[model samples]
Target: MFKRIAATAAATVLAAAGLVACGSESGENAPGEGNDTVTIKIGTTDADQQAWTAFEQKAKDEGIKLNIEKFTEYPPVNPALDEGQIEVSKFQTINYQAQYNASAGKDLRIIGSGEINILGLYWKDHSSLDGIEGEEVAVPNDPSNQGRAINVLVQAGLVTLKDGAPKLTPTPADIDAAASKVSVVAVDASQTPSAYHEGRPAVINNNWLSRAGIDPASSVAADDPNSELAEPYINVFTVRAEDVDNPIYARLVEVWHSPEVTDALNKDSGGTAVQVKRDKEELNAILDKLTEEYK
Candidate 1:
């Protein structure tokens, strides 16, 4: 199921780029190897956010020039990194990466940790989840987020799942409709805001809140960032399996957790992103566990 979805998403990206496949060959010398300042192309969806500006300046000071490639969606960024179109990417959760690796037969490695942008249930008409009972709620159709969205409703007592539903990535199929207070309407992550505007309460990812003119702090209910459930959703920086140990990548990760970058991130997220700083080994262990479950 994941392979079919991944292949379709990849084909869409390839067609958009007007290419059959991107070259997998390493494009440049490793950073900090000689007198030349090494340039690294990093992929992300939020390139225009203030955080990247701070990150770019910090990387420059370390003799690493960064080219920020802005992606409008999540599906293409991992494929771009896999094909060597970008050297590093920082947009997906470890759970999403695990699903991608399992479905695509790729072994991308997590090099650094990033913040968990708390997934929130937003509605213009309802001040709380109590008012959303027996109504249809919108969620991201993607596997990773759809599951998280369902979990959010479950936590809010607005939905219920069948016995033995996978806790890490539950889907609508797992929902006990008879017991659930609301029926889920899965849509593209980008269209969630649209669903909300059309009068359905929606589970909007943090990235789409601003586009919908919704404030981050206005969510009726949200996942607890510090909970055990959020461990798999920790956003991360990823590189090709071969570049996992590159000093330049390590330095970039170091700079990402610095006060300047984190402060900018907090500001951009409207203080909803919880900063996470786990080591590579710990992060990889979590990914490994999730990937196995996904497979």
Candidate 2:
């Protein structure tokens, strides 16, 4: 499913450049080339509220017009970015961005990282992992997120994966259910919260759970992002390879991580996301590694 979506995004990236660019015939919001003031179009999933408004105002004060293009999903953001409809986007983690680039053959690079969302096993009726026995639990079905969901279960002593199962992209088939306490039912990543509300214990993705209004502290178990296995999940600001060092873009990243927008980021993410200041070179190295591993 993810592969198909990625391919579609790639195809859009290939076909959307002239068609979607701002000055072209049919493009809606693409920036005008040679305009006196530069408008940097940014694709984002965050609600247009406190944090973003602060950043936009700061950018405006600095003489950069910030035009935000909102998206509800991740797949289309990259395509729009590749097509020049947006200059950069803040919607994906390092692994997801790497996977999209590898699958799409586009060199989208992470310019700065903002927050880390810890993925966890959340239950509606239950409060702890021990009581989860005999209850069928829901998990993400996508390769990367599924493996992450399963790993949390393993760490919580609920289930175990078979020997040699790829840790980075495991499926339910990799689970040794005979030795496990709970059975895992794989569903689309977006459906985990619904599955949980329907009386099933679910391993929900971080950002989605927060967006669904589920409190982060409600989770029974979660993976430690500080762990080496989970580092790839840190959410980042990404741009095309050509714009990695554009002074204006770099300034935006700088202002984003400063003390000015800290409260807004926390408030907007429901106080569940962690702010991390990672060097550009280090971020690129991790992306390169994940790209090679997942390719």
Candidate 3:
């Protein structure tokens, strides 16, 4: 599933790049120049969501045109933005971006903040974390989501971490199985729903809920978005380092926070998303700290 997502994202980016190349030959001034309407191409994983539909309409009303490219997974969005296939992307948390930046040696910059979707523990047969003792729980194996999933289990009092476990990026190895009530099974993020369907309670990311036919309100337990632990999980709108100060980009960020967009987003996520508002300086400081930690 991950490989397929990567391939599809790559193909979509290549096709978009071709269209951009052909469009460049018209010799028109770039967006945000003089009186030209600012047109920004945004890459996202949830372009089909009603939030984006509302965002597009609001942007149009504000005289800013948007071209949204949808991707199947989070991996390729940043690369698409870095390679100039898209101007900005809205998909990942600060921790995920920090890990990507550290590994890829790229300095993608976050220009705006987005909501944090509380990581949820969903069970098909169980209504609560209780009675799941000695059972196995599935979690996303990716560094960012896996760590958050482990934290969710910890918050639910079903798992205990060993001494000296990394606070931000804990793995199953960090879990003291002898002391914990449940054992964790890590699978690709895309397969978490499958794990849940197979009778194991799964720590599923919010983005997969719609695809897996899981109701967000049905989650047995979830991590608190307002806690200090969740600060790093706040989703963000990111762009190339050079575009960090672009006025049009700043305006676009404001548009994302508008009532229409937020209302639609809340509806789309089934109210699991907690809207976050943070300035760029604070966001950048958090990203810098996380990047250094990942390095």
Against the true structure, whose TM-score is highest?
A: 3
lDDT of 1 at 29: 35
Segments in model 1 whose C-alpha atoms lie over 4 Å from true places = 1-38, 70-76
* Per-residue C-alpha lDDT of model 2 across residues 1-295, encoded as one tens digit per residue: 1245643563365255523222222333332333333467788977465788877776666545677888987789998988877888887888898898889888888788877877889998567776778888899898668878887888788988889887666779999989899999999999999998887889997658756888778888888767666778888888888878554465567667656577777777666667877877889888998888767
| Model 1, residue 145: C-alpha shift (Å) | 1.3
Ranking by TM-score: 3, 1, 2
How does residue 98 of candidate 2 score in lDDT? 85
Please report, in order, the local distance difference test score of every candidate based on alpha carbons.
0.83, 0.76, 0.84
- Write out the backbone clash pairs for model 1: none
Q: Write candidate 3's Cα lDDT for 224-273 as tens digits.
A: 98776787899999999988865556667778888999999999889998
Give candidate 1's TM-score.
0.80
Listed in order, each prediction's TM-score against the native is 0.80, 0.77, 0.83
Q: What C-alpha lDDT, on a 0 to 100 scale, does residue 275 get in candidate 3?
A: 84
TM-score, predicted candidate 2 vs. hidden true structure: 0.77
- Choose the strongest candidate by lDDT: 3
Candidate 3 ranges beyond 4 A from true positions: 1-36
